[model samples]
Target: MLRPILFIFVLFFFKYTYGQNEIYELRVYEMEFFKPANILHDYFEKALIPALNREGVNNVGAFEESGETLPKKIYLLISYQNMQAHQDVTDALKNDTQFKLDAQTYWETPSEKTPFKRIESIFIRSVSGFPNLDKPADDSEFFELRIYESHNEDALRRKVKMFNDSEFAIFNDVGLNTVFFGENISGNQMPCLTYLLAFKNKEEHEKAWSKFGPHPEWQRIVKLEEYKNAMNDISRIFLKPLTYSQL
Candidate 1:
């Protein structure tokens, strides 16, 4: 009888621990030019990503601007099982011996040889409606990162409500492959939210947006009084994943 009771407790404990939503950290490395891109590439591909994987983090994505955008930037998207996992993985990586050795060259570079001008990090909590980051299918080659800024806190809440109440479902029906939707809890941007979407290529991206515009559900929601003008500004960047990107 005691054995059966203990087994049941173990089952409940595992379920409770593994069933929680995820958190995400998006890191942007800004470079003046391509001079340091090689070093940045080596660090991410050879050291950082592998270290994170050893800590049980997966689906890490490394990307760069697709076109001739000035002031080249690299984006890294990392997902954690929970907020605590984020902290734990970060702490674990710092002490990883192999990672330290692999990243030595990049770290020991002279001040003048730094790889990036500055790095920006954003911490976000996944929206309740889409609480886990989805890994794109192998064929996905393009990712669109979008930031929606609102006029105020109320406006941001309404915009997020729009997504939770109806927008995400519409996206699925319209063939948009959404990876994650996160509210920026702490970041350079205030009163904003960011999301990532994947596509097969440029053509697929254009086609998806075309379909989304006229979708009946979206048409109806756009006319809703509460959601009107919820977004005040928008910024978009197109990215292509690195060859070693896990996403």
Candidate 2:
């Protein structure tokens, strides 16, 4: 092998089999509060995103809650390259002096424009074995969307583990392919889990769900006391990706 290909090959074959190849998932959930909407848009554009970008945040943008007449909360799904990248990005923010200053400036500046209401943000990593995640989502076409919310921290972490652990195979076995999975971490609400499952289209999404809900393994897993108590509300919504999301 040539030097360049050999280098690339080591980066690939030696990296974990999956998400490490090209997937790093980060999802955000926000409660819809009128006072902070514009402030949020401005904050991301002017304050938060710059710091986040420096830390390797990708697909960073806010979106409205979809398929609703009167939407109550929104979410942002951000991607990274790997667990180490995710860890470094988050850890960098904690240690970054400029980020600390910017955060204070962001909150203080926003306080002048609008009042703040606390919202939850959690981050989760995606599990392997869901289909069609062979490349980065450069085109924005996806079909199955899934979100799981737990009411507390311990339970939320457990939910994250279930998706991250071997249990995630149930989704693949039932024909539900995952697009991206991550917990919310920026929007500020606590004890909530937000993730997305995208398919090729709406019909495929519906079929996937049909396969997911009634699978025999799922039935058995669903009966587990640990799974049952870990969740309080599980919400799912379909989102249409928009242009200029980086803005």
Cα lDDT of model 2 by residue, 127-230, tens digit: 44332233234443443345566777788777766665544687767655555555555334456654456555577667777887777776777777776677
lDDT assessment of candidate 1 = 0.90
Question: Which one is best on TM-score?
Answer: 1
TM-score for each predicted model, relative to the true structure: 0.92, 0.51
**Across residues 8-79, which tens digit of lDDT does each residue of candidate 1 receive?**
998997766766667889999989664647877899999999999999999999999999897888899999
Cα lDDT listed for each candidate: 0.90, 0.57
Task: Give the lDDT of residue 247 in candidate 2.
Answer: 18
In every candidate, how many clashes are there?
0, 18
